[model samples]
Target chain A: MDVKPARRTDSHFVASLEKAMRVLEAFGPEQARLGLTELSIETGLDRSSVQRLTTTLHQLGYLDKDATTKRFSPSIRMTELANRYLWSDDLVKSAMPRLIDLRQALGETINFSRLDGTDIVYTARLPSSRTSYAAMIIGRRVPALNTSSGRVMLALREPGERQRAIEEWPMQRFTSQTTMDREAVKRLVEEAAETGYSIAENELQMNELALAVAVNRNGEPGGAIHCSVSGTVWTRERLREDVMPRLRDVANAIG
Target chain B: MDVKPARRTDSHFVASLEKAMRVLEAFGPEQARLGLTELSIETGLDRSSVQRLTTTLHQLGYLDKDATTKRFSPSIRMTELANRYLWSDDLVKSAMPRLIDLRQALGETINFSRLDGTDIVYTARLPSSRTSYAAMIIGRRVPALNTSSGRVMLALREPGERQRAIEEWPMQRFTSQTTMDREAVKRLVEEAAETGYSIAENELQMNELALAVAVNRNGEPGGAIHCSVSGTVWTRERLREDVMPRLRDVANAIG
Candidate 1:
C-alpha cells in the first residue's frame, strides 16, 4: 500500500494533525532540509502558521532548528514516534527467525500479516534474501483477498466476515486476474479455510504464485504467513503436492 | 531512538496524528486485536473518535479493521514507513560500505552526521558489530557541541555561522563536561579547524573518548564522521594517537 495513512478523526484537533502530516510529507525523497519560508511555501500555509507549528514541533523533538544557520531538519523524534506506533510489537520481531528460515527453505518472498477489519496488513517480511524479489519493499500493504497471504488470512475470519468485506467495499481488482465477484471471493475463503492453506497462481499479476497458512496463537487467529514465487516457479500441481504440506508444517510450527 | 515520531509538526495537528498514531500504537507488545470500544478505553479517546480514526486509518494502509468483529489492528504500513525512511538518503546508502570497513578497522562505533542547523543529525552509522554502545539508532540526531561529531562539524562552520548558533541559543550544560562559555567554545572550534579534527573525552558523560573529522564537499563542510571508544577501552593517549588516523582516513574517503 503506498503507506499513506487513512483519513483522520474529525476532532477539532484533526486539522492540526493534517497540517503536521503535510509538513512531514513536505520532506520527501528530496528536500530534506528547510527554512521556515521554504516549509511555508511547500505546505501552502502562511509563514506564521508554519512558524507556529514548527516552534511547537521543535520543542517536542519532531524538528530541530540549527541555532546558527536557522535551517530546520527532522529529528530522532520520528523514530521515537514510530516506535510508539507499533515498534513495540513483539509479534513482528518474533517472526524474524522463522521468516529467515522460510526464506532460506522456500527461496521465495515470505510475509506475516494481520487482519485489519476486512483487509490484511503485513507486519513482517523476509525478502527472498538470497535472491530478493526486487518487487516488494518490506512494509508495503496489499489487499487481503488479492494476495495469497490475504486469502490465507481471510480464510480464518468468521463466516459473516467475508460478506461484510465484500459488502463494505466491492472488490477493487489489483490486477486483471483479481477476483471481483462476491460469490467467487466467498468460495475462495471457504475452501481455503477447509484446506488449511490458500494458493493463488498468477492472480496478483506480478505473475507470482504463492502458498499461505495462518498462525493460531492462544486459540486466536494471529494472521497469515505466505511464501511467494514468480511465474517461472509455479505449476498448480506443484502447489498442491509439493508446497501445501510444507506450508502446513510451517503454520503448525508457528501455532 | 524510538521508531515512531512522537513530536509531529504543529500542536494543533497533534490530536489527529496522535489519534492515528494511537490507533497503530494500540497494538503493543501485546493486545494485538482490539474492538472499537476497547480501543477507545485503551487510548482514552472516545468511542466515536476511535471508530472514525480507525476507519480512516484502515483505508489509508495504516490500520486494518476486521469486519465481523469490528476490531482494529496494525497494518504493514508501519514497516513501509520505516523502509521509506531508511532509503531516504542516497548519499548515506552509498557511503555505508566504506563506513562499515572503517568501523571494523577502527574498532569503535563509527558514525556520519549532517549538520541540521544547531543539531547534528545522524544519517548513517556503523556500530561496532562486535560490541554494543548506549544508543545508536540510525536517523537519530544529537546536539552539535555536546558530541564530538557535532564539534567536528561546527569546527568547519564560518565565524558568523558558529557565532549565530551560539547566539541563537546559548549552550546549555548537558553534562559536567559541556563547555558553557561561548568564547571558550569558539576558541575550541578554531583549534579544531587548524588541526583538522575535534576530540572530546567524557563530554556527554558516557565516559567515552571520541575523534571526528569533517567532510568538506564543494568548498563547504557538509558533515562530520566520528569514531568513539569507551574510556574503559582506549586510554586517552591511545585514542589520540591510534584512532585519529583512521577517523581522518574515513572522513577523507567520504569527502
Candidate 2:
C-alpha cells in the first residue's frame, strides 16, 4: 500500500477529509463500486483505511455489501446524495406536468434541458418511442455540438459565447447525418432564431429525428425544452408539418 | 464558530478528505450553492479550509465558482462521477434499453428504480412529457413506503424483511392518499403480488398517477421500472386498461 503523504508540520490540511473526498470523487462513470482492495489500489490509501471508510459509509447507507463477495457497491443512498444537487428543483419533477401534456399531444418523446458549459446537459428527458438507444438521464451530458437541444441552448446564449463555443468545438458527424461545418450550424440556428424553432434529422443518432422550440420564460427560460419523435416512424416532412407545431405550442406554454 | 470535530481527536481518520466530503456533502437539495461563509457554517469547517478545498475542486472542474461573489457550487461534473453507476452491468445501466422501450411504448414516464431501505431510488428515468412535478434525478429518493416504486420494491423483499420494515416504522402518509397502515400495506403487497405490478394513484403526490412493475432476473428483480403521469389526465379506467397493459408489457421485456 502507498503511504499517506506526509503531513505538513503546520497540519495545514485535514488529510482525512481530503482522503474521504478523494474516495468519494474517485467514484466516477467508470468506477462505480469498489472492494477494499480496489479502493486501496485506486486511491493508494491503506487497505485498513479504505476498509474503515467503506464500513462507515455502509453504516450510513451510502454503500451496500454484496452478500457473498462482501464487495462494497454504491447504495441507493448515493442517489439520495446526488439528489441534493443545486438544480434540485428536479427538472424532471417540475416539467412532468407540461411534459406529459406535450407527450400526449405529440405522441412522442420530449426533453427538458439546461446548459452545462457549451454542451447541452439533459436535466430531464422523456423517453423516445423506440427501445433501441441509451436512456438519457437527468445529468447526462452529450456534445452541444451534436444535439438539437445543445444547438438550441447555444442559440440561446449570447452571440459571442455561441461563436466561441462553436469555434472551441465544432460539430462532428456522429453518424453520416450530423451537421459538419460551422456555416451549416449557423444557418440552422439563424433560421431557428428567426422562426423560433429548430430541427435535426439523423444529426447525432442514426434514425433519430428531433424538433425543439426554445421555451422562453414567461418568454424567459432557465433553458430550452424539446419534443422529439423517431425518424423511423415520422419522416422529415411529416415531422416538420406535424411535430414542429405541437412542440412550438408546448414551448410557448412553458414560456 | 464550532471548533473542528476531528481536530479534537488525533485519531487515525484522514481529516482533510472527510472535511472535504463534508464540504461537498454540505451542498444538499435545499442548499445547492454557498459562499465560503455559508460553507463554513454548513460544514463547521473554518473558512480557510473551505476556500482551499473548493479551490482544488474548482480547479478540478467538480465545483464552480462565481467570480463576483466567490460562492462555490457543484458543477455537473459531479454528475459525471455518479454516472459510473449507470454503466455497471446488471446493476443499473443494464436496464436502460428496456426502460427506454417502456417509456416510448407507454408514452408515460418510466424509470429504473431500486430500494434503499425505506426509500425508492430513481436511477434512470424517461420522462413522458414536458411538464414538471415529479422531480427526477440520478440519486433522488422517495420514501419506499409512500411510492408505487417503493411498494413494488418492498414487495420484493424477503417476507421477514418486509415485516421487520413495517414493524420498525409504520407508514406515514405524505398526502392523505398515502398508505398509513402496516396491515393495510401487507394487504396491498398481497394484492400487488397477485397482480404482478404496483399502482400508486394520487397517493404520494395528490395529483400524480404512478404505476410500477419490477424488472426481475427471473422471479426476483435487479430493480424496478415505473411510469408516472399526471392524475388530472388519467381516469381509473384508463389506468387499468391502458396503463397496466403497457406497463406489464414493458415489465415482461425486463430480464
Candidate 3:
C-alpha cells in the first residue's frame, strides 16, 4: 500500500516481490516475531496474500519460522544482502581506513554517512571504547536536516536544491535543543559552506556534540566523516581547537 | 537456477522473488556493478527477465543504476533489511555488551556466529585495533568445519549430527596451514567436546589463531563466541593460560 503511484502503474514493478520484502521488514525491534495474523495486520495485506508471501519468504531462507510458536522472524540470510551492499559500496570501501584512523586518533565515535533521499544513512561506523549497542550499529538513518553530516552534505549542494530541502523536507524535534527553525538551519548550512565543516550540539542526542567534514569523490561531495564527543566532557571551543583539524585531515584523506 | 527441487515443486514458492534476490546477490566484492547482459549470465536468466528484475529492484530503491554506465549495483537501502535483522535477533542484542566487554578486556577481535546450513555466518563482529576491512564485516560466512567457533558449535551437537557434518559437509583448503585431514578435524572436535572450548591455529589465516566457546540457549548450543589473536604474538600454551578462562566467562555470560 506504500508503493508509489508511479511504481503502481509501471509494468516492470513486481508487486509480489515488494510485498515479500515488506513482510521481511515488518519484523523489527517492536515486533521481532509475528504470527500470521500479526503479520497480516502489520503489513496491511489480506491473510491469504500474507500467508503466501510468508511461506515463499520462509522457503527462500529469508524468514525463520518457529515450529512451536508459528511466529516468523528475519533469518540470518537477510544480513547477506547487507554484506553484499557493504562490499559493493565504493564510498564505504574508500572511507573505512580513514574512519578507523580517526577513531584511533580521537577515541570517539566515528561515522560515515551519505545522503539518501531525505535522510542520511550511516554506511560505516566505528564506535569508541565507550559506546552503546545502538551507537555502533550501521545503516541507522536520521533526517538530513538534523545531523551535522547531513548539514555538511546539504551545504555542498546547489543553492536551489538546498533551499528546496530547507522548505520541504520533513523535520522532527528529536531533542529539546534541536533546531527546528528553517532560517536557523539555513544559517548553519551557510556557515558550513563557508567554513568547509559543520557542527551540531545537543540536536540529535542531549549532551552530545557532533562535527563533520564532507568527503569529496570525483569533484562533488560523496559523503561525510563525523566525530561525536560528549558535551559534558569538552567545551565547543576546546573541541574545535583540538578535534576539527584532525577531522578535516581524515576527511581529506578519504576518497 | 539454484532453486532446490523441493522448492521448485512447492506451490507457494515465488520463483520471481527468488530470481530478484539472486540478481541483487550477483553484485558482490568482485563484481560490484553489472550490466544487463552480465546479470543475465550470472543469474542464468534471460536478458528480458534480468531487465525486468533490475528495473523492479531499482524502482523499489534496493538497486542503484548508473546513468552513464547503465550498470546496476545494490543501493544503501539494502542495508535497512540487515539493520532490521540485527535489531530483531535476540542473541545479537544479548551478546553485544558481553562481546564489547571481551574485546576491551582482550584488546583482540571478537565475534558471535551461528550455524547456517554448512556455514557459520558472523552475526556480530568487533574488530581489534589491528584489523582488516573484511575481518570487521558481519555476515561473512566460513565453512563450519574449519572455524573454531563452528567446531565448538559442532562439538556441542548430537553425536550423530556431528558425525554427519564431519562426513558429509564440504571442506575447502583456504590456507597452506589449513587442516584438511578429516581425522585431525574429528580429533579437534572431540577435544572441544571434552574441553568445552575450541581452538584453530593457522587454519583460516596463516598467522591467526581463533578460540571459541559455545553459548547455550535454553539447554541447546545457540551459537559460539570467538576471540581471534595474532599467532605471531601468541603461543598455544600462553593463549590457554592467559585468555581461555576470560573467553569462557564471556561466552557463558552471553545467551
Candidate 4:
C-alpha cells in the first residue's frame, strides 16, 4: 500500500484573510489595475469573494476604484505601510548609510536586497550619477540564480534549503551569459559561499556587471549589499580584485 | 415622528477583510512589530481574531513572524506591492521625471503627495544633495491643514467636499506658524485655488518652507508636486518670484 503525507493547517489561520491578501497580490507592476472578473480569475476566487474583498480593501484605503473603468488599483495607503518598514526596519536603517557610501566609492548603482522564497527583492537602491540601461527601482524582483545578490543569498541559506532551491528553481536564460544548467548554477553558489562574495557578468542584462556580498545580523545572512556597473567601465578582473574588497568592507560595517 | 438615516454598506463589503487590513494598519513606524495581544489592543479586535488574521497574513507573505518572540511585522512583500504603485501607477510615473527636474533646478527637496482622508501621504520623494534635519521618507503622513501640498490638493477638491474638509479637519499646531484657525486655513486654500499655487512657511517644521501646485489628470486633481527648502536659504519673496513659476511649469508638464 502507498501512503501520502498529510497536509498541515494551523487551526488559528483565517481562510478569509488569506483569500483577501491573495486578491491584493493579484495586482502587480504589469497589471497595476484589475477589474473584478480579472481579479476573480487571477486569485482563483469567485466573483462574489473578489467583490467582497476588493470592496472591503477599498474601504480600508488599500484599493482605489476608478469610476470610469470600474477597475481597482492599489491606493497610496499601501505605500504608507511599506514606508513604515523602510523607515523603521532595522536592516534597512543599518545598511542605508553604508550603501550610500558604497555608491560614492564605486560611482555605480548600489542595491540592498533580501531573499523572498526563490526570488530576491530589492529593498533599497541608490542610483549612480550616470544613468544606465538598468532601471533600479526599489522592490523590484528578479530570479535568484541570474543575479549576484541572489547567488550570495542563496549560498548563505542552510545546506539542505540551498540544495532544494538549486534543484527546484527555474533557470531561465536571460542573456548569452546566463547559466541554465543546474550544476553550473550550483558551482556558482558554492563559489560564492567559499569566497564570501558573488559576481555576475552579463547574466541578467547584456554588458552589465554586478557583485554582491552577504550581510549578516546575529551571525546569520540577513540580506546583501551589491554594486552594479557597466561592463565598459569595469572588467571582470578589476571587479573581482578591486571592487570586491570595498563591497566586503561595506557589508561588514552593515552587518 | 423620528427618522434616522440609513448606514451605507455596499452589499459586497466583507467585514473580515476590513478587520484583517486593520491589523496590518495597526503596525506603523512606532509599532514596527507587534505581538498578538498588542495587535488586538491596537486594532480593537479580539485576540483570537488578531491571531487568525495575523497567521493568515503570515501565510500570504504580507507579514513575518519573529522566531524568538513570535512578534508579527510587515514583510518585504508589503514593499513590493507599494513599489508596483510607485513604478506603474500613472500619476507617480508621470510626475517622477518632472519632480527630479524640479529637484535639480532648485537644489531643494521635491515631493509628490496625495490626500488620504484628512491627511496627506508622501508618495515619492527626491532629496536634496545637502541633507537637512527634516525627514522626508516616502509615505510619511501629515495633517492636511499644515502642508502646502495638502492645501493645493484640498483646494482642487469639489466645492462641497472641500468645504466639508475645511470644517471637519483637525487643525493642530505643529510650529507657531501652523494654521490652527479654520477660517484662516480656508482663506489660504481659497487663495491657492485662485492663484494655482500654495505655500507653507514654518508650518509643519519650524525652519522648513514648502510650495506646491496641483497635478491634474483628465481635468481633475490627481495629486500635488511640491518643493521644500530651508527657510534660511529662501525668503517668501524669493520663493514666489524664483520658485513658484518653475514649480507651476513642472506641475503642468506632469499634469
Candidate 5:
C-alpha cells in the first residue's frame, strides 16, 4: 500500500484567486487567444474550473471574449495593473528622465532592469530608430548571471550572496559567445565590482554589445542602466572611451 | 414591511477571485502602499478578507510587502500581465513599425490608442525629447469625445453608435479649451469623418496640440495614431499641411 500526502491548503492563501491568475497568465506570445479547452490544457486546470475562471475574468473586464469564435484573450484593462505598478515604483519614476536623455544622446536602445530573484526584469525601455518590436516591450526577464545588466547588479550585492549567485544561479547559453565557465563569469563580476560597470559582448543577442552600470538607491543596488549597440558598429575601446562616462553619469543621477 | 435584494450570486462567477482583484486594483498613484485597515477600506472588504487576499497575492508574486512597515504594494511581476496584453494585441503589434517611423520622422510624442467602450486607452507610447513621465506611460484613458485620437476613432463608428457616445459618454474639462458643448463635439466628429483626420488643440493639456488619424483593421476602425506637439510652435494650417499626410500614411500602413 502506498501512502499519499494530503493536498496543501493554508488559511491565508486563496487558491481560487491563484487559479484565476493562471487563466490570465496562460496568454503569451504563442498562446494568444485560447478556446476553453485549450485554456484548460494550457493552464492544467479542469475544464469546469477553466470555464468558471474565464467567465469570471471576462465579466470583471480583465479578459475579453470574441463573440463569434468564443475564444478568450486578455483585455486592455489588464494594462491597468502594470500602470499601477509603474506609477508606484519610485525607482522607475526617477529613472525615466535620465533614461530618455541617455536614449537621445546615444541613439541606441536603452533599458532599465532590476534584479528579481535570479533574473533581471526590464522595467522600462526606450527604443532607438531601428529597435525591433520584441525588444521594445517591457517586462521581459533574462538570466542575471548571463547578461551585462545582471552582472552589474549582482556585483553590488554582498560577497557571500554574490558568490552564491555565481555558483548556484542558472546560466543559459543565449549565444555562442556567452561565457559559460564559472571562473570567467566570477572574474567578470569581480571586474564590475572594481570598475563600476559591466560589458557583455554577443551574450544575449548575436552581434549585440551591451554595457551596464548599476543604479543605487539609498546605497543599495536598485537596478542597472543598459545601452546596447551593434557589435559590428562598436568596439570595446571606443565604447569605453565614448559611452561609458555618459552611462555612468545617467546611472549615478538615478535615485 | 421592508424588502432588501439578496446578494447576487452566480455559479460561473468566482466572488472571491473578484475580491482578490479588487485588492490589487486599490493601488494607484496616490495609494501606492496600504496597510491592512487601509486596504480593507479602499477595497470595501472586511479585514480578514483583505489579509488573505494580500497574502495570497504576495506569495504568488503579484504584491510586495515592506519588511518593517508590513504595508503592501504591487510587485514588478504585475508588469507581466501588461506584457502579455501588449504581445497578444494584434492592433498594437502591427502598428509598432509605423508608429516608430512616425516618431522618428516627426520627433514628437507618438501614441497608439484603441477604443474601449466610451473611452480610448493608450496602448503604446513613444516619447519625444521633452516628453514627460506621465505622458510616456501606457494604459492611460481619455474620453472619446474630447481627444483628437478618440474623436477620430468615434468618427469611424456607425452614426447611431456615434450619436449615443457623443450624447451619453462622460466628458471632463481637462483644460479650459476643452469642447464641452455636445453640438460642437458632434461637428468635430463629423469633420473627422470628412477630413480623414482630426486635430484637437489645447484640449487636454494647456500648451499641447494633438492630431490623429484612424487605423483600420479588416475595413473596420481599429485604433488611432496620434501626434502631439507644442501648441505655441504649431499652427493648424502648418500641422494640416506638414503633418496630416504623414499621419495618414502611417495610420494606413498599420493593419
Candidate 6:
C-alpha cells in the first residue's frame, strides 16, 4: 500500500482529529461498510488504531457496526451534521426555492453545486420526475472537469488557481464523447467564461446532457446552478434554446 | 461556567478527536459562525485548545473562517461527508421513492425520521407544494415526544430506556396544545404502539397535524414515516380516512 502523507507538524494541528476524519473519508459512494483491515489499508492507519478509532466513533453514535457483517457504516447522526452544514450555507438556502421553481418549470433535474477540492458537491438538488438515476442527490460529488457545474465554476476561478486546478486534476475520459485532451478542456473552460455558461454533453454519462451558469454573490462566483436533461430527449440546439435561457435566468436571479 | 465531563481514560479513545467533534456539534440551528471565545465556551475547551482545533479544522477545509468577522462556519467540504453519511443508511435509500410517491398522493409534507438521543432527526423529507416550513429539512432535530414520528419510534423502544429518555428530555411547550405532562406523553406513546401508528395535533406547532407509522424492518421499528398537514385544512376524521391508510400502506410496503 502507498504510504499516506506525513502528518503536519504545525502546533495547532490535532493529529488525532485528522486521523479520525481520514477514517470517515475512507467510506464513500462505493465503500459504504468497511471492516478493520479494509479501513486500515484505505486510511493508511494501523489495524489497532483503526479499531480504536472506529470503536470510539461507534460509541459516540457516529458509526454503526453490523453484528453479522462485522463492518462499520456511518450512522444516521451524521445526516444531522450534513443537514445543518447545507442549511448553514447562505448561498444554498437562498437558491433552494428558486431551484425548486426551475425544476417545476422545466421538468428536468436542478442542482446547486459548489467547487470543493477538485470536485463539485451537490449542496442542493431537485430531481426530475422521469429520472430513475439518483444523480441529483444532495451531497453527491463529481469531478470538476467532467461536470458542467464544475466547468462553470472553474471558468470563473481566479486565473492562477484555475491553471493550478487544471494541471492538478486528471482528465479521464468517462465516455466516447468525453474530451480527455487538456487543451480541449481548457478551451471549454475559456468558452464557458466568455459565454457566461457551460455545457457537458455525454461527458460524465452517455445519456446525460448538463448545462450550468455560475451564481455570483457580490460579484464573486459562489457556486453554479445547473440542469441535466436526458440525452434521449435533448439535443444541443434544443438545450441551448430551451433550457439554457431558464437556467441563466435562475442563476442571475440568485446572483 | 458548568464543568464539562472528563475525557474517558480508555487508551483506545481519541480525546482530541472527540474534542474536535464537540466543536463541530457546538454550531447548530442557532449558533452558526461562532468566534474563538464562543466556541471555547460552547465546547467547554480552553481558549487555546479551541484555537488550535478551529485552526486545524479551517486548514483542512471542514471549517471556513470569515476574514472580516473572524467567525468560523462549516465549509463546503463538510457537505461531501454529509452526503456519503446519508447514503450509507440502507433504510433511507430504500424509502426514498416510496416517500416521494406518498408526498405526491397526500399533497402534504412527508418526513422519515429516526430516534437519536432525546430527539428525532429527519433522515429524509419531501415537501408538499403548499408547505412553507423548513422544519422538515433533513437532519433538523425536534423533540421526540412532540412529533408523531418520534412517538412512533419511542413507543417501540425498551420500556426502561423510553422512561429514561422521557426523564432526560426537556418537554418544552412549543404550542398551547403541546402536552407537557410526562404521564400524558407516555400514554400517547403507549397508544401509538397499540394502534400501530401515532398522531400529533397542534403539538410542535399550533396549526400543524402530523401522522406517522413505524417503518418496520424484520418486525423492528427501523424508523418512522410521517406526513404533516395544516390543521386548518385537515380534520382528524379526514386525516384518518384519507392520509392514515396511505401512510400505513407505504410503511408496510417499505417494511
* Top candidate by DockQ: 3
Candidate 2 lDDT over B46-159, as tens digits, reads 889887787666655667787898777777555544544454435555566666666666667777777655666677766543324345456666667777776676676678
Off by over 4 Å in 6: A1-7, A129-136, A158-168, B1-7, B129-133, B157-170
Quote the lDDT for A47 in model 4: 93
The total of clashing pairs for model 3 equals: 0
The DockQ-based order of candidates, best leading, equals 3, 5, 6, 4, 2, 1
Order the candidate numbers by lDDT, best to worst. 5, 3, 6, 4, 2, 1
Please give the range of 10 consecutive residues that has the lowest summed lDDT in model 1 chain A: A128-137
Residue-wise C-alpha lDDT for candidate 3, range B1-255, written one tens digit per residue: 146878867777878888888898787778888999999999889998898888888887888899999999888876777777788787888778777777666778888899888899888887765666777777787889988988888998889989989988778788998988888889999999999889899888788988888987775678898888998888888778778888788777775
lDDT of 2 at A230: 73
TM-score-best of 2 and 4 = 4
Tens digits of per-residue lDDT for model 1 on A78-194? 543334334345455455556655555565567667765455666555443222322333344466766666766666667786567655643557667777776777777788879
**What digit string (tens of lDDT, one per residue) describes model 5 on residues A136-234?**
878777789999999988999889999999999989898888989999999999999999999999888788888999987776789998988988889
RMSD per model, one decimal: 9.6, 6.0, 2.0, 4.6, 3.8, 3.2
Q: Is candidate 3 or candidate 5 better by DockQ?
A: 3
List clashing residue pairs in candidate 4. Answer: none
| DockQ of every candidate structure | 0.15, 0.33, 0.61, 0.42, 0.52, 0.47
Give the lowest summed-lDDT range of ten residues in model 6 chain A: A1-10
In terms of lDDT, which candidate is strongest? Answer: 5
Write candidate 4's Cα lDDT for B1-255 as tens digits.
011122126566676777777787788767888999899899889998887888777766788899999998888877777776675567777666666566656767778888777888887776553433124456788889888898988888788988998999877788887888889889999999898889898888788888888887675777888888898878878988998898888778877
Question: What is candidate 3's fraction of native contacts?
Answer: 0.59
Query: What value does the lDDT take at residue A204 in candidate 2?
Result: 65
True contacts kept of 1: 0.20
The TM-scores that each candidate's chain B achieves against the reference are 0.68, 0.82, 0.95, 0.87, 0.92, 0.90
Instruction: Report the poorest 10 consecutive residues by lDDT, candidate 3 chain A.
Output: A127-136
* CAPRI category for model 6: acceptable
lDDT of each residue in A90-152, candidate 4, tens digit only: 877766666656655565777889887778888776655343313445677788887789899
What value does the interface RMSD of model 3 take?
2.1
* Predicted chain B of candidate 1, TM-score versus the true chain B: 0.68
Residue A228, candidate 2: Cα error in Å is 3.8
Model 3 C-alpha lDDT per residue in residues A1-255, reported as the tens digit of each score: 156877867877788888887887687668878999998988888998898888877877888899999998888877788788888776677667677666666767888888898899887777765566666677777889998999888988889988999888888898999999999999999999999889999998888888998887675678998888898897878778888898788777775
- The C-alpha local distance difference test score for the whole of candidate 1 amounts to 0.63
Question: Which runs in model 1 stand beyond 4 Å of their true positions?
Answer: A1-15, A22-80, A83-87, A129-136, A170-173, A203-205, A239-243, B1-80, B83-255
